[model samples]
Target chain A: MARIDLVDLAHAYRPNPTTDADYALRPMNTSWRQGGAYALLGPSGCGKTTLLNIISGLVVPSRGHVLFDGVDVTRLATEKRNIAQVFQFPVIYDTMTVRENLAFPLRNRGMPAAAVAARVGEIAELLDLNVDLDRRARALTPDAKQKISLGRGLVRSDVAAILFDEPLTVIDPALKWELRSKLKALHRALDLTMIYVTHDQTEALTFADTVVVMHDGAIVQMGRPNELFERPEHTFVGHFIGSPGMNVLPAKVEGRTADVGGVPIALGRSYSAIPPGRKIEIGIRPEYVRLSSGEGVPVRVERIDDLGRIRFAKVRLGDARLSVVAPPGVRLEDDRSRVSFDPAQIHVYADSRRIEGDA
Target chain B: MDKPINNAAWFLILPAFAIVLFNAVIPMMTVVNYSVQDSFGNNQFFWNGLGWFQELLDPSSELGGRFFASLGRSALFSAIVLAVQVPLGIAVALSMPRSGIALALCLVFIAMPLLIPWNVVGTMWQLYSRSDIGLLGWTVNAIGIPFNYTNSVLAAWTVLVLMDTWHWTGLIALLCYAGLKSIPDAYYQAARIDGASRWAVFTRIELPKLRSVLLIGVLLRFMDSFMIYTEPFVVTGGGPGSVTTFLSIDLVKIALGQFDLGKAGAMSIVYTLIILAVCWVFYTVMVTPENKGARE
Candidate 1:
């Protein structure tokens, strides 16, 4: 396993990109620790695939260098870079049996036949594919074929890293969980650096130790799953993560309090200097916002969504819509209610970037 | 839910049935009638009682000897062309550009030969391989190869095979190119990341994906070459001691040149049965679920 360092890496499909909008992946510096389970999480066309491709050496960056274990491998071809990738769809050799498919990468590198067989057996057992070792890859189900695709990468012992570009896209819904758990188990057994790219928050949150959230063409936040949940680094991350996502409302902030549509709310931290002419906002998770009897900012309850375990009220605070947790047995008077935000959970954003405040 | 049954839907197939009957059934019945009877001048006929069939099956008889010889020649010609063209076509397909104006131009050039009319292809090859005036024949003779397609059996077979290859290999190449186009870019990327060599990638990824198209190419080429008549007939004229006279040419000679209606009709039926049987075997072997599952 090797630590992957992206030194100011950026890429654009066209030559001579003159603006940030032209780049598929904007310039950024990041390092993935060896054996770390990381997820590159983003929506479609957000450049997650472009960044993954750059890491796997499928696409060379337009600027900067990719270093593996401190060795610069910016221009190295995919085969020379010693990385493995599983695609959005299962890409198995159709004519080969499961055992042969697993052994392919090893055989391609001229590994000894005995060693290849041993590794293939280990991978098949790990993937729970021992019963299908002799079956043709084309005859298996999609999930089984996807396991074979994963096995091909895992069979190579010297592989530096493994990249997955939404590998579970084609799997059945029931099998997605089973396969995901199997991947988690595999990660525990084999301490290889794995980069999983996906748009699903649940997949990213559960599968990754660290979720690198990308927005537009750049990484907005990279932190532990809980860190992302408790404190999203940017407004995009706050809006993108969680079920209802973080409720962001335009506000005016002064010293120790913020006014949301002219209603003052307490702030846990105090700001000394407010940036001039910047759009100010406050982000709070729906879990932190609660419906109160009469003590907090008044809102109109638009609708109550019962998610079986807990209820959430979609409420309107002045002109801004907000989602707040509705306590069981709490009745609203004519759909007019008040919601209180846990001041510690409140994060202030200045022009979409999180701004730190002092106590 | 119970479904309603309508007999009126059956009428939709009448036009197709009529077309098949007029094109296939009526002509086949006429041949069957001729096969069972002897015909003389002025359409005079006498019942032969399968005498032509009996004579045609016996190797010592003139009709049987000529029929078996031509059948063997046709089979050999089919084998030779298929063996040469399939590999050459695959190579040509692999070398073709993936996309751009160059790729479009390349496809157009590759498809040019297939668009030519059969008679034109035949006439063109006939003149193209003349030893005295043609580019190919004159070049070979100038290189001290002593090639004369009109008098030499070897030269006649060579020109016939070359002409057939040139006229049809493009069909196989285009089919293979289409198959190649359907393969996703992810397969190649996966293969590369798996440390696969160029040859390994072609064999393990590309060749397997091209299997269905290759089957079509092989089937079409085999059938076309087996029943080949126009090009070879025009160029070799089944001459040079009857070496290049295939089954179709022999059947034409018996039916038209010698006017032996009974023998020619019987031969025609047998030739058609052979082609049908071969096609059945090909379809069954290549497309059966068991075979498809095993191969794919």
Candidate 2:
């Protein structure tokens, strides 16, 4: 386990990064504790892979430092950085057998042949790839190839950190949950510092202990998985981290209450540093939005989605529509519907940044 | 069994196949027929069996030794061409930018040699290797090195070798460059993350992927070099004492110049077999399941 420190790292694809827009990765300063499993989650062009590449030393930062175990290694190459990385697709040599593919790095490092073989066998068994020890890598299917890639990255327990950049993207949906669980198990067994970057929020939240949410080249917030979902600090985090994302309704804040679409809702607490007489929005996750009769916004039920475990009643209020999660068998029985939510669960945001909250 | 006769498509292929049969297959068959028989004059012939093959097989006598010497020269020429061109071609391919003005400039330069006719290239080098007027020859002579292809076998071989390299290295480089360009940038990115040394990336990735293209390059170069006649013939004219006379040049000398049709035909069959066999072996080794797409 190693404490990773990234001090003011910024990257730009273009030679001259004149403005903030020119940078693919906005300036970031963050750190991770030893033996922590972390994930950088974002949309496709949100600089998640770029940040991963920068950390793996595949991309050089235009400014600032990256220190692993307090050693300044910003200028060092990937080979000198002492980190293992797995690509989005499997990157094994097609000519070599699975065994040879696993043994290549160890042999290149001048590890003992016996030790190399033993480790290769162990990783092969872990990946359920022992039967393919002598089979050519080219002959394997896409899923098998990805397993080899995952195994290769995890094979070396001696590396300071292991980085993965969307390694499970090529995997099938049915196998994704199983593989993600396996990765979590591997991290627990080895205690290696692992950093995973993915665009899928579910993948990040479920697999990582801490999820770092990035948006438009900047990290909006970083916290534990539950913290990200329960209290998203930024609007982007709220929309990004959950399925049937948190509903953000445009409202005007008046002291401790918000008047949303001619309906009054109490915030139950005052927010400091944010002046009242401005356009403010209230955000609440669907799970926290309690739907009942005649207590909240006057809206018409557009449709109802039955997901078996819970029902999502999509209601249109003024110009915006909000999804409210109801208990199973709850259906929209009326055209004109009234659904309400707890005021404590509501998060206030002025612009895209969250207003100061106790959460 | 009922078979459909598609006469409409047949019309398109009939003319092309007829032309090939007349120009290529018939001539080859005539050679094959001549190889097994004794051709006297005006199509007068007698059966000769394997006597011609027997004569070339034993290299003790003068004709036998000449046959072996020409074969050896052909092999050496091919070896030299492979040695100079494959690495040089790969280096040039690697250096070429994938797109834009730099690639355009590279394309223009690579196309220059390809545009020159084989005989013209030989003639160009022949004049360019003169001790009096040519820059290379004049420089060498002025620097106190006696450089004359008319006399020195080494000088003639050097001139012809350089001419061949100039004629075909561009083709090899272009083929390899196409293959290299087809490789995804992801492979390089993966290599970077894997912390591969430059040589390892090149050896494990680039070179292995280049296998198919390089096979085609080698086969084309080998066939061209083996059957080479025009360029070397025009430059050195088989040299003083036949030092640069390749098998093709020797076959032409026997069949057309000296009118030994039977021997030339036999040697032609042998040459074709050698090329076919070698190329088949190359295709098999490179495109096999274990070795195929090894780089990917």
The list of candidate 1 runs beyond 4 A from truth reads A330-333, B1-12, B288-296
Please list all clashing residue pairs in model 1, or write none if there are none: none
**For residue B184, what is the lDDT in candidate 1?**
97
Give interface RMSD for all predictions: 2.4, 4.3
Off by over 4 Å in 2: A271-273, A276-279, A290-295, A306-310, A326-333, A357-359, B1-24, B33-68, B95-104, B189-195, B260-262, B289-296
Error of 1 at B214 (Å): 1.0
* Docking band of candidate 2: acceptable
A1-359: candidate 2 lDDT, tens digit per residue: 47889899888989989999998888889998889999989999989888887777888899888888998888888776778888887787766788888887776677899999899999998788999888888778788888887777777767778888898888889888888898898899889999999988888988899899999899999999999888889988999878889999898776777778877778856765576565679998988876666566667777888886768888887787898886554567765457777878888988877877543
Candidate 2 per-residue lDDT, tens place, B1-296, comes to 99998779868888899999999999999998888887887879899998777776779966678788999999999989988988889999988988999899988899799899889998899889899898888889999999998999889888988999999999899999999998877678766655667888788789878888998998899888888999998989998678999998998988899888888888888878887897898778767755444433
Candidate 1 local Cα displacement, residue B17, angstroms: 2.6
lDDT of each: 0.91, 0.84
